[model samples]
Each structure stands twice: as C-alpha cells, then as structure tokens.
Target: MIATPVSSPAYLEYGLDTLFGRITKRAECRIGLEQVENDAFCFAIRVPSPLSDDLEQAKTLVLRVEGRRLQGTVRHSERLEDDSLRLEVEPD
Candidate 1:
C-alpha cells in the first residue's frame, strides 16, 4: 500500500549547532509519512539551506504532528539540486 502525506501541519524541533554549544530551535514545515512496517513509520521533510545546515548537525529531533510530539533520530539527509534539504527520520 502507498502511504500519503499527513494533512495536519508538522513542526521540527531540533538543536542548532553553534560555536559555543547547541541551541534549541523549531520550524514549521510539511512532512510526508510512510509506514515501513507494522507500528513503524518514517517522516520526510524538505527544508531550506539555513535550516538544512542545522539539521545536518542534529543528532535527534522532535516532530509535532497533530499536537502529538514524537522524538526521532536523523536517519538520513540530502541536499537537493535547489539547495534545499530532504530528511528522513525514524522515531524511537
């Protein structure tokens, strides 16, 4: 079966790496949800350069979907041709 994107708005909360340390930050973005197996899901988001840079250094993240917060690790990320970033997250 094909999975569809969630209709509700999604927000990404992650730590931004800085010279001193990491700072918490959040961004509103759209995400696509796919079920890899029973009770397992994958989240995908596309973000701009600035946010992408932060995500590259992020080890874990919090995703708010429909008011429910899910914590996950940054499983994979890639830079698109337009300089935006695409990320895939697997929730613990």
Candidate 2:
C-alpha cells in the first residue's frame, strides 16, 4: 500500500496472521492516518483491547497485531509534547 499524507478517512481490510503459520480471514478495521513525524505517521485505530482470554479451539492471543478495512475521520492535528504529531481520529 502507498503510504502518504492522508487528507481524508481511509477504509481498508487486512489479513490476520499468526506466528505459527496460521492465517485468519480478513476483518474490518477503522484507522485514521495523521502526519506525526517527518518520516513516520501515527495511525489512530479503533480496535479495542480484547475483553476475554479463552485460548481454546479458535481463541487467539493478540500482540502488536496489524489490522485492515479501516475507516476513520480526522478531527484535529497538533504537535505533541515529545515533539511528535498527534492526530485526533474518530471512528466512522
């Protein structure tokens, strides 16, 4: 995917992959990309933390996982205290 300065909310779909060579179907996720660093970008995502931990037949543990099918809206953008950019993204 081409990463650039996002002017509008972008919607995308991403595949979920595990470390054990397992792949799950694509899921819907929303994201708002905001210009933060000179070369890096801060993506505000709306995927909440998992509320349950049941590793059984189809349960999974997520850690630093990437998502797709993202849809978001840019509310505002500003500089952070750490000299980084902070973009307020609300899920649409």
Candidate 3:
C-alpha cells in the first residue's frame, strides 16, 4: 500500500491485538497521516483506551485505509490528556 498524506479526516480501521486474548474488533478511528515514508507513516489517532490495552511494540496490527489493506506493528503508543491513545505505525 502506498503511504500518502491526507489532509482531511482519513478513516482507518485499527485492529489491535489484546493481551487478554480477547476477540479483536475492528475499531473505527479517525487518524491523520502526519508523515508518509517509503514503507511507513506516522499517524495520530485519539483512540479510547478502553478499546484495547496498550499495544505492545512490534506487535502485529491491522490497518485499513480507504479499503486499502495494510499490516504493521505497533511502533509506539502514548496516552493523550483526554485519556485517549495515540499510535505510531510501522507498516509492513
């Protein structure tokens, strides 16, 4: 999948793997592609923490952008002031 910058709200599906071995649900989140690279991109999404536990680094994760299928590992995750989660994805 091509990594391109999107100005408007780009819809992406985040499939995060849980540590508790619960069912992985496709949680829809609005994200902005901060920077796009050859095979990776930086994004910030205000995802609710309750949706999933802290995504482990290098953990396999699923991303769907405009129906464009892409897989990546969790490079980083930060908790926002609003108790939301922010993620940096490393696409594979």
lDDT of 2 by residue, 1-92 (tens): 23333233333332233677644333323222433334233244232222112111122212122433433444444444543333444444
Give the per-residue lDDT digits (tens) of candidate 3, residues 10-62.
34434544577643444455443444334335443335544444342325556
Total backbone clashes of candidate 2, pairs 3 or more residues apart or in separate chains: 7
Mark the 10 consecutive residues where model 1 has the least summed lDDT: 31-40
Scored by lDDT, the top model is 1
| Order by TM-score, highest first | 1, 3, 2
Report every candidate's CA lDDT.
0.65, 0.33, 0.50
Q: What is the C-alpha lDDT profile of model 1 across 11-79, one tens digit per residue?
A: 888866678886887778665445544444776555655444466667678877765677777777778
- Cα deviation at 22, candidate 1, in Å, is 1.9
Clashes of each: 0, 7, 0
Lowest lDDT 10-mer window, candidate 2? 51-60
Best by TM-score: 1
Q: What is the lDDT of residue 73 in candidate 3?
A: 59
Q: Give the Å error, residue 47, model 2.
A: 17
Cα-based TM-score, every candidate: 0.59, 0.27, 0.49
